[model samples]
Every structure is written in C-alpha cells, then in structure tokens.
Target chain A: MPTSDDKPTPNTDEPVTGAEADKAAEIAAAKAKAAEEVPPKNPWEEKPVAPTHSDAMDDDDVVALEGLVVSADLFTGAVTATVDAEKILDVCRFLKEERGYAFLVDLTAIDWPEREEGRFDLIYWLHRHEDSKRVRLRAILGEDQTIESVESIWGAANWMEREVYDLFGVIFENHPGLERILTWEGFNGHPLRKDFPVEGIDTGAAIYPDVYPPGGGPIVPEEGEGA
Target chain B: MMNGPERPLFDVEEMEISFGPQHPATHGVLRLQMKLDGERIVEAKPIIGYLHRGTEKLFETMTFPACIPHTDRLDYVNAAHNNQGFCITMEKLLGISIPPRAAYLRMILAELQRLASHLVWLATHAVDIGAITPFFYTFRERDEILDLFEEYCGARLTLNTMKIGGLPFELPQGWLDRCAKFVDAFPAHIDEYETLLTTNRIWKRRTIGVGVISPEDAINMGLTGPPLRGSGVEWDIRKVFPYDRYDEVEFDVPIGTNCDTYDRYLVRIEEMRQSIRILRQCLEKLPEGPIMAKAPKVLRSPEGMVYGSVESPKGELGYFIVATEKGTTPYRCRVRPPSFVNLQALPQMVKGSLVADMMAVIGTLDIVLGEIDR
Candidate 1:
C-alpha cells in the first residue's frame, strides 16, 4: 500500500524559474500556516472506528482456530479469514451454526494467475442478519485443486459455485449437476482468468469478425481431393 | 389407433420440456429444462448465461470510474441501485466520505429508482400473469419515472448517474419538484393497480398459494429483497446496513405473512408505498452542499476487499470489490445480483406446482435476467 510516507516529493535539485519559484515559496508558506492551524472535526472525514461491540471480530486479532483459520485480517471494511482449503467446510459450518452467520451473501473467485501463494482465491461472504454483520472467508486453491461444496449448508451456493466453476474453472466437490451456469456448455476457456484476453477469443467453430473476413462468418476452404 | 388399448390409463411418464430461450413469459432468455409429471412440475433446472457479456471481466479491464457504466447493464432495470452498489463499494475502498447533499441526492435517485424498478417489475409481472391492463397503467407511471431520470441524467434505462465518490451530475433544475409531483400522485396509480388485480379472482387464482417458499427455506436459499420479505424474513439491507443516509429516512420494511405469491405481491405493493414515503422525506430534507467529495483525480485504493450492498427493488444488490495495492482498476469486481441468488429457489418453488403456474412464480420472483446472467 502506498502510504503518505512513501509518496514522492518534488525534486530539490532542479533550479526553479522566476514566477514558478515565487509560487512554490508561496505554496510552502501556505502549507506551513495550514499545518499550524488545527484541523476541524469534519464528520465526513472521520476514519472508521472499530466496532466496540463484542460480537464483531477485531481486525488485528487472529481467530486462533488452529487447524481451520490460518490467518485473519480486516481490510476495506470487512473481516476476511484465510482458511485452510480442505477445512473450509468445517470453518463455514462453525460460522453458520455457532457464530450465526447464516446467510451466504456471495461466493466468488479472484484469479491471481501470477501469485505464488495460489492461482485463485475462492471468496465466500456470509452475512449474519441478526447483527447486520458480513464476514468474508477466503480459501486459497492451487491450479486444478478442488474444494468441498457448501451447497448443503447454503442452498444459494449452488449456482454461485457453478458460476465460479464456469468462469474460473474451480471445481467444487459434491456439487450436484455442476455444469456451466454463466457460460454455455462446451465453451472453451474460463473467461474470468487473468490471462484471458479482454477482446475475447475466436472459438474456431464460429469465425469472429476480427478473425476471418471482416463483418462476416467463417470462410470455408475449397474442397480438396488430395492433401 | 384411438383405442390403442387403453393408452395405459394412469400410466404416468415424466415429460421433459425446454421452456423459453425465446419464450415471452420467461422474462429474458432464461431457459428452464423442466421435467413434468402430467401437468405438475417435477424438476426445473434454469439454464442461464445467454446474456453474459463477461461483465466482471469487463470491469477488470476498465478503470474504476469507467466500470460504473458497465454496472448499469447488470441490473439494467434497477440501474441506479447497481450504480449505487458499485459506487458505495468503491467509496469504501477509497475511504472517502461524500457530502451530505450528495448522500441525500443519491438517496433520492435510489428511491426513485426503486419505484421505477418496482413499476417495471409490476408491469411485466402482471403481463406474465395475464393481467394486461395493469401493464399499460404501470408503464405510464414508469415512463414518468424514466422521464425524471432522463432529466437528471442524460439517459433513462442505463442511467450512469452515480460516480464513485458522490454523483456524476447534480439534480436538474425543477427535477425534484417534478419528482415530488410524481411521488405525490404515485399512490393513486398503485391504488389503480390494486383495484384491478389485488382483489381480482383470476389474479388470486394465478398467484395465491403458488410457488410458496417457507421462511426457513427462503433464508437457507439466501433469498433477499421481496421474495425473502414475502417469506416473512423482515430483512432489508436498507434498514439493516443503512447505506447512503437510509438510516436517517423513515420507512417501514413490509414483510409478508403467508409466504405465498399473493403475499409477495402485497409486499411489493406495500414496498412501493414505502418508497414513496422515503422519497417524500428525501425531498423535504434535501441538503445543500457540494455534490461531489474531495476525491483524488484518479482513484486508487489500498489493497484489500470490501462488500457494499443496497436494498434494490428486487433484492440485495451487492458489489464485492477487491482492489490490489496501488491499483486503479479493481482486481476483481463481483456483482452479487439478487436475481441470480433468488433464481436458485425456483426448482424448489415449482417442484409440485402446475406448469402454467410457473409463469406466475417467475412473475412473483420478479427476476431480471440481465442481473441473473451477469
């Protein structure tokens, strides 16, 4: 993260021109004066304070679930628990039944094709409506690895898991009828993969406009007697 | 041939029928591979993705601010809510607070959008249920709402009216008065719709006790918005999460008791009234300040993830944004569309219901395939 400490300052060695130098000196003086002035208590500018309530998980603390949660961190307004891939089912059950995070808000995958930790991060967002709290659980999976499906816990995860399978090629073990949900069956590549081209690929069956004759279909080759 | 020996009377076979890749009542290109035992549905497997434009992928390639317009296309009918969800998530990621005026403006637009979306839902849902006249009446008010949207933003359906920090444009001159006028008279139109279908015998027969989802099943299925509320969940993100000044507004979260299609209908009607109440409050309390926050010229969020949701007309419209450290574009932007989640309950809902009642259930669900297929 690029904090204010890491921000680049103006080059001090460069000789400044007359008007520009004057403006720079004036800006420095204004900044010095502004620094001396006490900042107002602007409500909009208030930073997010960690909730004082007991139920809310502290961002900085690890849950200490020895085998299940490897590490937990709070960032960007939600607590994300990095769980052991094989133990995701156990962690989800714990959250749903014990912790009361019943509703599965969303299940999605983030593809990190170059990351050494894993190829993909399967994200599950669970919402506990009673406390209006949402917690995100992330399970790191290597290429071609499979994770247990949570359809038994949350029926809503059925389509969502299928979507992740369709778009990211992540397999969900025990997912009933895990066919493509967002893409047609027999579609070639996982489009959401980081390596997938934004312009899209030309499936050889249908000649894409950018591929064959512009503004038209595939060009059929002349019949050949001998090759 | 006619006497083909008792065509085996009482010998029942499950018939598999493919419904709607193009059928009118299926909403969009939602195709259901339904297995039927006589006229009763045994299984219904919805085949989606006809409208998938690789929106999440599209979001990846575009800059943060540029992704707002694409969000508009996900839930095209509820475009403002879509915009709101994306904008709110982006704002959370950037840690910027929008001005009070901007927040109120967003609420006004969002509530109006709720009205517009529900009207569209009512119009098409009624048309699907064979109530044709309500479609015309609902569209009249819907068109007025669209006109209001057009005056505020430049477009009606795909209103990219919201920005990441605040809003893209201020409310047009006299737009609020027109909106107030429309809000003032909107209940009478709801009354007209009610007079036509709320008590109609055919409407009741088509909707009541059909596609029923129990409250427990609804929560387990992760149903949100009206379907969950209709099942008596009493959960509304607007009230629960309270984004963009919703906590300051006064409106009831109408929930249904019977958990039937009729109750869902009643819930939606009551919801439109509640939207009006919210809209009236926003209009009265519209604040005065800069509409845009002091956001950076280019938006770049610190590494991590955030999930922000709004209670759209259909359900919880959420955006799960994952921004990498020092990145202008989101590493991943997942749209938690309500229709997609709500559609999961279809097989369960229609299992024992008649095939014809399928349309009624689809109507009651009020799904927009754009969101589902996204």
Candidate 2:
C-alpha cells in the first residue's frame, strides 16, 4: 500500500473545483424551482375568513317584496329578510307560489326580552330545491304578538309552529290544533324563555308521590335527626 | 242475502286508543292518539315530549365545547353525526377550519357512525316488522362498530369524540390498520344482511307499498335522508352542500323510483354500500398533516347566527347557533332534528292503513323519540 503523503490529493485551499461548483449551482437552481412550484396549502393551513353580513337590498326576491321586507341581510351565502309581521302570510304565499320555496326547513324563535323593537324574533328557514338555495324570513313579535301560520303554505310548518308556540309561548294565529308539544298541557311557564331557571322548576307531576316529596326528591335526613 | 240476526248484527263504532308511551313498536315514548274505524286507522296523532330533556335550553348554559356531549344525547344511536353537526355550526360561527387529517378522521368516524345508526334502524325496524332474525344479524355488525368506537374513544353509544378546532388525540398505534380491516370486511357483512332480508318474500310483502308518500308530499312534509331519497328526490345535503371533505369523496346518492316503505328500505341498504365506497376513497387519499389547527385556548365566537347542517343517517341534522360577540356560550342553540320533522308526517303516512301496517310505517319513518322530544 502507498503511504498517506504519497497519494495524489486535490487542493484543500479552494472551496470547490470547477466540476463540483457546477453540480452545486445546479442543485441550488433545482431547489429554487421546486420551492416556486410547491403545492398550495390545505384548507386547514389557511386562515379562515369569516363571512360578513352584507345588505341584500338588490336581491331579486327581496326587491320583489317592495315594502314587506323591513331589512334583508345576506350572511354566509344565506339570505335573511326581516319581513313585516302583519304581511307574513302574504310574503310566504309569494315565496311559495312565485319563488318556488316549497320546503319549510325550520321554524323557531329567539327571545330577546330587552329589545325595544320586539321581544321575540321568529325565524323561518325555507329551501328551494331548484337551486338548493335557502332563505330565512325573520319577523319580530312583541310579548303577546301573534303571527300568521304558514301551515297551509307548507304542511311541514304545522308541527314546527306548534313547537315554537309551546316552547316560547308565541301564538300562531291560524295554526290548527296548536297545543303544547314538548310539555304537558297544564305545565306552567315556558321552559325556553330567559326567565326560566336552568335547574328546572317543580312540574308537580311526580311518578311516586309517596316515596319522593313533590318539588323535591327523597329528603336527606339532618346530621343529628337520623341514626 | 241471508238474514242472520235482527236489529244490527254487530255494533261498529269508531274507537280512540293510545298506541304507546311504553310500547316497543313506537321506538321510544311516542304516544299516538289514534282514531280507528274497525281494523283500519282513521287518523293518527303523534303526542310527543315524554322524552324531552330541554336539550336546547341546556345548551344555553354551557360553554361551546362543553355542549358537544349534550348533542350526543339528542340522537343517542347517531351521536357522531350530532357531534359533527354541532361542531360544524360552531366552526362556521368561529371561522375555524380543521386540519386535513382531522377532516379525514371526522369523515371516517361519521361514516362509521352512519353504518352504526343504520344498523340500529335496520335491527329495530326488522324486529318491529316481525323479522327477528335480521335484528340478530345486524346487531352483530353494530357491535363491531361500537367496538371500534370504544377503541377510538372510551365510550360507545354517546361518543363525544369531536372537538371544535380538531380531534382530541391522534390515531393510536395500529388504529388505521384495524379500521381498514373492518372496512374491508364490512361489505361482505352487508351482503349477508341483504341475503337475509332484501329478497325474502315476507320482507317484500311487509314493506312494499305499505307506507307510500308521493315525492311532492314528501318534500312538502320536509322528509329527508332515506325518506326523501325513497321518494325519488335526488336531494342529499352531502351532494348539495359538501362539508368536511365530502366533495372530494366519490359516491352516488341512491334514489328510489317508487316512494314506499320498500323503496326506503332499499335506499338505506344501498346507502350503506355508498358509505363503504366513501370510506375506501378517504383511506386512499388521506393526507398527512397536523391534526389540530392553531386555535386560541379559549374560543370566542363572533356575534351573529349561523345555520350549518350535516347529512346524518337519519336526515339533514342541522344546528342553528346564535352567538354574541366574544361569548363563550351560545345565545340560542336550536337543533333542527330530522326525526322530529320526519315524525310529523306519521299521520299522513299511516292514514287508511291497517293497524298492523302502522308498525311498518313507523319503522319505515325511523323516528327516534330521543331526537323528536329533544
């Protein structure tokens, strides 16, 4: 074997030789091109942008109902029109007949007791299958205000209106057989109202009155009162 | 004409009867105040609320993340979809997109849940219709699904496995392999179930044309999921509003030609196969990434209302959440339960059918009183 010093060695002073320098430059250029051509980030990696509510005053359906719509808001690609409570039936009929919103997706109420305009906001979600578009019609109601029932327009609203009536105590004017749905007929107080306690009140409909006391379960004995 | 007896042979008076608050065929505490003309049902009025736990009211008092468990209780058999619907609505309100891995995981879990839910429906429905054998067959598969669920999360029935921004944990060791094994074996099991019921004469006679609701009537009544598909309306929330990687998955929405109990049954069975197809695709194209998004420790929602829906096994399970600015808890959370809306059409479905056929109609509707009364 040749001695270590006798072997032919390249110069250590220069950083890179001509051929090696060419290879390094090619690798760097390839890396830069690859970085430029990197795939787009996934939906989750991107920051989510919240949808802002825009004025839907120029929407075709909102424009059609000239004075009926109090205000129309478009948020997250869904249109919500605040319509007059008095002309709800007319507007519902117009939507059903003219606009083909045959499906009443949901009907519910949100209680805003402190609002000066109204105490309850009734939301009606309607779906048109032609384009899979949904529109919401919100009508404000006072504490004792009654709105017209869209039972005849869409049969699906019959039970939904009754549920609102039962839970929020908002009466539907023309709802046939509008009885309490989610509560007993004689149960006192609307359970969904803001004033209702979360722990629940005594409904006085005890199953075993003898074993458990009314409004309270089996009484726990006091520290000194029981053995 | 043979004159057997004088002065009216038998008195035929319309009778009113309460069907169930505890009957097995009614599923849960659904009591039907029915008017009957001899053996035929004149009218059936559904009296619900016995199972009502004030779920919506309870939602108002809890933090956004804490409310996930309560949603599981809404449809006990289909808890995963309920969690998904609530989380989707919450995510929309907070404007937080989940990671790719989380989305794929959610799809897998949800499809598994759909399989489980439909299995329960089939078991209960078959038992209700007097085919007790299919119950035994279906529950075997349902137990394996529940086992997978128990392996993933600690709970089986009420699996609160989802979080707002992402999943709570990454997949355990060999979890994906086990899930793949199950997915591969599930199609054969479905075939086994079909062999037992699909072509059986008794199943056909009991289900075919028993509960017929026209397509227009089904849409007007707001029927969804299998019920809507059974009426030949090709409307699926998955196809219409693709959420959580559903758009990337390739599957067909099985529609029915004739709107009947049999068609609905066929639709659900085919839907099970489509779910398998989706699972295969999701498994093949599952991307590797961080499971959780960069979310704040305390999630605060913007002030507004958002309505987000998912294609649940039952139907379009929607959660309409109303949030105040920077509020941790929802102002008003409304659950548009599919069973509640589907159960509303019971009166129309069972009218003029025999008393025995009422069980078939109820089974076909697949109304869960837990959801109906929620």
Candidate 3:
C-alpha cells in the first residue's frame, strides 16, 4: 500500500538515466530467472517450496492435462487458466486445493461457430486467496455437450453453472440447481449459442399476452400522435 | 368478543411486490421479484437479462476490430475500460508492443474514465439513498472528464479511440496539462464526496454493517474489484500482471476489512484517489514516441490464443481470444467481465438481509446488467 505519505517524491519525477536503465535491466534479468524457478503459492502458511512469479512468462500458463491443451498462469496475483477443455472439474480442483487456487472466478463458454472441435470452449477462471494466484481452466466442449461440475469447492458455482447451461447449452452434471437462469420456461433455443438467431425480440422484455392483444401489450401505447 | 370477531376474513397484511423493468431504482430494465411482509422484505429474487443482446454470439459473426465498440455498450458507464481490455487482447494476439506514448495516453484516458464512472456511481448511489444535491455536484466534475474525453477522442461516451495495435492517433496538444490539473485537484473533489456521504448518519445507517461479506466467502465466491478488496483480498491484475506499462506506474492497492456496502463505497473512493495517483505518475513520466505499434494496418496474428486484461474500475476485465490459421475473424472471443463475476456473490450478499437492503447490496455490487447479461 504505497501512499503519497510514504512516497515523498513522485515516482516519475526522476529521469530514467543510463544507470537506472542498467539497474532495471539487471533487475528484470534476475527477477525473470527467479520467476521461472518457483511460482507464487499460498502466502500465509510456510511451504517447503518457494512459489515463483509468472511475470516473464511466454506460453507458460498453458497446461496439457490428459489429452487437452490448456494453460494455467498467474495473473494479477490470481491464477487465470486457459483451457481447451477435454476435461473440466478434475483439472480445476487439482489446481484448486492441491495448488491452492481455491476461488472460482467464473464459468463461461465462448462459441466459435466456425471451427469444428474448437467450436465451443468452456472457460473456468479460478483464484486462490491464500497465495492470491489466478489460474484459468478450460474444456473444449463443442455445441450440444456437457462438462463436469465444480460445485464441490465453491457454492457460488451453482448459479453460474445454471447461467452457462441456460445461455450456451453446455450442460453441467450434478449441479444442485442446474435450471434455466435468464430464459423463461418453454423458450426455444440456447439464445447465446453462436448460431442462434437474435430474433423473437421481446421488446421491453415484455411478457407474452393471450388475447388478440398478442403475447405482450401493444408495441407502442400512445394517447395521441405528435411529431 | 366483537374485537375478536372483527378480524379480517383473510390475512392480507403482507404482499409480494416486483420492482423494476419499469421502476426508477433499477437503473436499467432489471426486475426484482420481492416477497414483502409489511414494508419489510421477506425474500427477493432478481430476474435478470431484460436487456440481453446476445453480444457474445454477435462477436462470433463480427471481426476483431468491430467488436471493441460493442464492448463499450456492455458496461456502458466504463466504456473506455471495456475498449482498453479488447485492444490489449487484440494487441497481444498479434504480439505487437505499442509505443510508450500510447500506453501513457491510455493511463490518462483510463484514469479520467474512472473518475467519470465513479462520478456516475456517486451520483446514482446517493440518489438511490436520498441525497439529492450530490448528483449535481458529482455531475459537474463528470462533465469535465467528458470534456477531456471529447478533447482527446472525438466521441465522449463510447470512445473507440483504440486501434488494433495501439491508437488511431496521438494525444491532442495541451492534453497532458489539462489532465495533470484534473489529477492534482481530483483528490479535493473526492474529499468533497466523502464529506457529503462517508460520515453522514443516514449514509452510514443505510450502508455500514449492512449486507456484510466475510473475506473467506468473498474469495470463495470469486468476487473481484472493490467488493473483493473490501473484504481484504489484495488482488489487482494491473499491479499483479502488469500488462502494458501498468508496471511503470506506481500506485497503491486499497483494501478494507469490514466487507460491507460501506466498505465497498470507501474502497471505491480510495481507489479513485489511487487512480489519480497513477495518472499523475504516468503523465510526468510519459515519453515522446510513436503512439501506434509498428504492425500491419490490417493486422493478423499467428494461429494461437492470447488472453489480455486491464484492471478496470470494476475489476479484472479480460479478453480471451483464439486466432486461427486463416487470417480473418477470431475463432473465439470471450470477455470475462468483472461485473458478471462480481454479480455472482449477490445472492450470497443478500440472503440474510431485509428485502430493501437487497437493492443496497446489489447497488454496492455496482453491477451493470449489460455486462452481466452480455
């Protein structure tokens, strides 16, 4: 928590002269080496191994878990994983407790719509509070598919799972409440599925009505017309 | 006997009321189905996505450059933050390093954007809690920020200033002076906001100790931004990951222990102060160099993936992009919006509180449903 009180002079006030540049370069080299040696782990408790920082990483976050190509790297003191999910929760919990990446940032699916096996990828971004590291876990599940559920670690995953299920049609097995989140009952398609049409506009999110009044009320209700 | 017999036929003392989709407090077209017992809320359920445009699906059809502006609409209040996140992702995928000046200019724009965004938050939050005059005061400062935006970028609201690599142009002349003045004086204005709300009795009664979340729960639920920091988790991607020149800028990451609505409000106010600090550091240290990255105008990345992010006012705003061998649209583009993740903790935040406090909890969460629904 570096405050103005702590820092008397502004950091940018001094010039980055040749000596300072040399110092920075030297620091960068040493720090980059240290970053590779051991990644940052849980901070509160003592650990046998020293945790390294993922600062100078180049293609380091990606992890190859059992027939899947995914990367798990630390971002902003949080572990953010990039996954091509052939496997989901198995890989996620491994990072969760074993690696201390306890928090589940979010569970989402991105639709490619163009590629074949890579048409849809399920993404899970996890965070560890103790170490304050983030790792992303992903499963490359195509459209019309289901992936593993991680309601075991974070109870908050239930609603997120429901939203993903409702929006992307990527089912999560064993979720306590894996029901539609935003969409109404008997709604046709996974509205967020890439190929799904943005049609049947529920203008004003109006509810469907029964009479000749149509499903909702009039499209525009006006007492009189004026330009 | 008559008094006993005079009891109403039906016990209709309580009623279930749904607010929003039309109400004033919702901000957007959000509906809250609340079960109330005599003006006290018993249960509340947020029926969301009244404004869903399926932007994620739409991104699949559009090219990378075109998607940046659409992001502006996601969390409309923090449009530049959204634009910055996308531009960073695009730049990373192509493996292009932007000029030093562009990064500095970005810091200035982003900090000002933060001020404007917080101004809106202050205005709206106060209005929600019955402070009438603060909105006008905050808006006056907010207009200055918008004027700064108009001076730099042609558009004020949805500023599509960022190009694929760096920026379409450089900062207009005298921009730095104006920004420096703003950063220097912004702290006093923030102090003014605090004077109006922070210690005010009604503000505290309504916010402090209301909708409290513990640090453990906040981390477990994946809450980020001020909400997570309010619970004492010192995690901010700008400081942690250090994308662009965020490493060059020096600032503090503010945290709170109480983890309540008031803690969040305090954390946000402190964060604005810190943003001003970073802006000053960036402006003084800004270098003279090209603004754009030296890459092909019509850019294409080698087939792979890149996830780029910035520490937005809300939280970690990240873009997950997968580029294919074919040099065209991205194979996949996923925006991990902070507001979306922050909203996940809402049900947890409001479970034990009175129904009206649910709005306070949600308001404190500071979610823009567009990002939540996007």
Candidate 4:
C-alpha cells in the first residue's frame, strides 16, 4: 500500500524514534558485516609474481662440468648450463659418456637477433636412464658461427640437428647430412627466424598455377566491398 | 652356360627406390628413399616435412593461452595430450598449480584420448599388416571414445579442450558416467582385438622378428612410449615426471622383451589396459573443487625456459618454452614431438628387413605425420 519514499526523513534537530534508530543501527551493522565478509582477491585478480632465475652453481651436476660450463642456473627445477658454441660437441660427449646421460631427449635453437652476445641459443636436452635425471645445455652462437654437431655422441641428434639447421639456419659442422629438413632443399629463408613474416612469403609453389598466379588464390574484395 | 649357373644370366645390382610422399602404407606423407639389394632393404632414409606448417614460429607470435589450440593441430589424432603438454609447460613457467579436480579431470580426458589413439594405431597397423577386420572392430570402439570427447568438449579430432592452469569447461552432466561406462567395456574390445591378431599366425609371422630394435639402440635413438618400452625399457613420462596428478594414480608401465613389431603391438595393447586402470581410478577419485586455478587475467610467464612432457599415445610429447620477463608470448616454443623424434629411427628399423616388413616397422612406430612434420 505504501512506497519506501513515503517514510519520514530523519532530522538532526528532532530526537529519532527508538524503533527507527534501532533499525538504522541494525542496517549499519549488517553493512559492516558484509564488508568484512568480502573474500581476499583470487590469484588471478592480483598481479602475478614473476619467477626469478636461481643460481645452480652448487648443484653437483653443474659442478661436475666446472671448466666446460660458463655459467649454470636452474629454471623450473631443471639444470641449464651455458657452454661455448665450440665446446658443445665436447660437452655432449662428456655428458653422454661420463655422466650416463645416454638419451638426447631434444635439440632445438632459439633465435635472438637483437642480443649483443650471439644471434641464437642452441638448447640440447639430455636424459639419464638411471634415477631419471635430465639436463639442458645452452650454447650461444653468432649468426655466421658454426657449432660442432653432437650427432656422433648421441645418434638421435641426427634429425634434430638438421631440424635446428632447417628452422633457425644454424650451421652444424660435421653433421652427417645437414640439408634442409622441414622445408624443401631450396627454401629461400629460415621460417623460424624472428624476422620472417608470420603470414608467410610467396614460395612460388602455388596450387592451380594455371588458374591462379603465384601467391594468388581465391581473391577477396576489400573489407567494405565484400558482401 | 645355362646349366653351369643361373648367376650368369644377369648381373646383380642394387636398386634405389623412392617409397612415398603420397602412399597410404607410409602413413601420411612420409617418404623413404631406400637403397635395396633385391627385396631386402639395405638402407632406408626417412624424408619428412611434407606437413610442416611452421607451428613453432606461429607459437612465437601468439599469446600463451592462444597457443593451446595450435598445439591441438600438432598431433591431431592425440590432441588431448598435445594440449596437456603445452598447458603443463605454460603452468610450469607461470608457476601456477591447478586445483585437484582439474588435475583428475585432465587425467580422465588424457587417458580416454590415449585409448582412442591406440585404437587408431591398432586399426591401421592391422590393416597395414593385411588384416582388414580389426580396422572395423577398432574404429567401432574408437568412435565411442570420440563421442565421449564430443560430448565433453564438442570436438573429437582436434580437441583444444584444456586451458593454461586447468580446463576450459567443467564436465557436462552425466559425462563421467558415460566415460566410466566406456572405460569399463573397453577391455573386452581389446581382448577381441587380441583374439583376432595377437596369436593369428599371419600377424605373428609378419610382426615377430621384424623391425627389432635393441634396448640400447632404442635409447640411443631417443625412442619413448611403446617403442622404447617395446624394447623392454620401462620408461613412461607419467610414471617418471608425474604431471597432472599422475602421481596419485596407480598403473603399470607395460614393457616388451623382443623389441620387434609384435612386442610393440603387445606393449600398446597392454598400455590400453593400463589406461583403463588409470581411467577407473580417476573417475572414482575425481574430487569436488574448482576446475580452474587462480590465475591472472592476462597470463605472463617469467623469464627463462622450462621443458615439460607428457606420455602421449605415440611417445613422450614435450613443450619447451622460453619466455622473456613478464612476456605474454613465448620467445621460443619448441615442441619435442614424439613422432618426429621417433620417426628418426625408421631407417634403423627398416634396414636389413624385407620391403614388405617396412610396413610393419612404420606401423609399429605409430607415428602421426601431423606431429612428425609440424
């Protein structure tokens, strides 16, 4: 029958009614309780804490290769050692022979075109069967520098070295067959380099060459012109 | 002269042949350049990369979360493992631990995907070895698993169902019951497959003593999954690394002694049974909790690199991510595709065997070209 606005307005000059004052106090108390009950911000809502690289100098494995390893650090509980590009072959041999890291889990390269030290970071992940231990070796190489291949150490490095060469254009000297792998024999450029185009360049191997010109297929009209 | 020797009729010479970039027996665009002494393979060189789409380069351009779908396309048949591998690596880089329920749910989906992948392998491997009936039988069961996947995530083949810290969506109502039912009935189907091929004289004669790789050579070739286990090496990423609550579940790592095509086949069939054991455990112990972890809206990974792997159906599928400080996109994301690495051993396996046995070797490897050429 009545609306909320029909309630009388409290005045500073007039003494407030007891029931109304109690009700007002109760409302204030409920609001305070609600404010207090608000949960802490979830991890997603807060600024995430960035992980820091920790020194792995004290690790036994890193210490085992004291002279060969330039520096060692731990990332996500895995030991990563930076070795000279020239000594990658030696390091791999030592790890495989002496350290019992018989398995070459993976070999890949990361391109850093703008870095002052080198243009690429070559990574080799090795694993040991006993105790299931793993280690990652990082080798820095200049754009024109060639790193010795570890294919002789671990037979598994054959295609992996080729893949690194195919993708990043890193030369693996003495690699049995270092020709392009993922790409054809005469692919113009290494597609994995940061400078390469994401949309892809014209490889001149277009489908239906007679019907559509090289780099041409099913042309679409301009944004507003298309239906 | 004709009675003296048949050798004088013709001069013996080796033949060089290009096997396939299109042939079905090679399985998805793999070409093997072979130097053969008559019908025996003297040397077989695997030439891959027909399906390479520069997926790693694409990962560099996309944000951390955006790369999950791209991983699905790597091993298209085993997309769930690919997604899990990428998500686990990203979580490691981001230092975000997912909720328990999410972990169990991931295990369930991953095991189901494993079963589906093995079924595909068995069907194709059987067909490749000249038994056509297993193809129909295996695919029949595989479709049910795919239907379960479709019910859960709406995509059967390339399921981009996982998220960085957890899952994209919680299970639909009655999804677990359906999955449980499938897991329960899957062993009998496996038995049916074994009855058809395990002891069949043709299958045994074709597979046994064919493509035999010694344990040392298998490890030297960096083989994983059944191929490595087929060589009698008891190694599994789930048991070794224990990602995604694999530590909580109990399952056996099936190994084979002979290291031939038949042993690998037995290893995979036993693996499907072990996957059932894992699925049963997960379905029962799926705890009630959040499906997603407490993560930032815009995921930013710390500077450095991390390699995280999962036991995909083919082998040890890994994602190696190198992130810049607080970078949303990976500086470099290299996928250690199991098929790509395992396919490297094809030449080793096919060598010194008959030309027809090459089919059995390729089949035993269980390599998917999408992952191999990615």
Individual DockQ of the candidates? 0.33, 0.51, 0.13, 0.47
TM-scores for the candidates: 0.87, 0.91, 0.79, 0.91
User: Model 3 Cα displacement at B153 (Å)?
Assistant: 1.2
lDDT string, candidate 4, B263-307, tens digits: 999999999999999999999999997888878889877789999
Ten-residue segment with the worst summed lDDT in candidate 3 chain B? B296-305
Clashes of each: 0, 0, 26, 1
Interface RMSD of 3: 12.0
Ranking, lDDT, top scorer first? 2, 4, 1, 3
Quick one: best DockQ, which candidate? 2
Cα lDDT over the full model 2: 0.90
- Chain A only: give the TM-score of model 3: 0.57
Candidate 2 has which clashing residue pairs, if any? none
List residue ranges in candidate 2 displaced over 4 A. A1-43, A46-48, A215-227, B3-9
TM-scores of chain A in all candidate models = 0.67, 0.79, 0.57, 0.74
lDDT per residue (tens digit) for residues B1-374 in model 1: 38556666687999999998899998899999999999999999998899989898899888999998898898888888999999888887777788888899899888888888888888888898888999899899999989988888879999998887788787778888898899999999999999999999999999889999999899999999999999999999888888899899899999999899999999999999998999999999988878887777777677777888889888999898888777999889989999999989999999988998999999889899999987
TM-score for candidate 2: 0.91
Q: For residues A172-227, what per-residue lDDT tens digits would candidate 3 score against the true structure?
A: 88887677776765566787765676554444443434322546455543446443
Rank the models by DockQ, top first: 2, 4, 1, 3
- Model 3 quality (TM-score): 0.79
The stretch of ten residues in a row with the least summed lDDT in candidate 2 chain B is B1-10
Over 4 Å off in model 4, which ranges? A1-49, A206-208, A215-227, B1-10
C-alpha DockQ for predicted model 1:
0.33
Which one wins on TM-score? 2
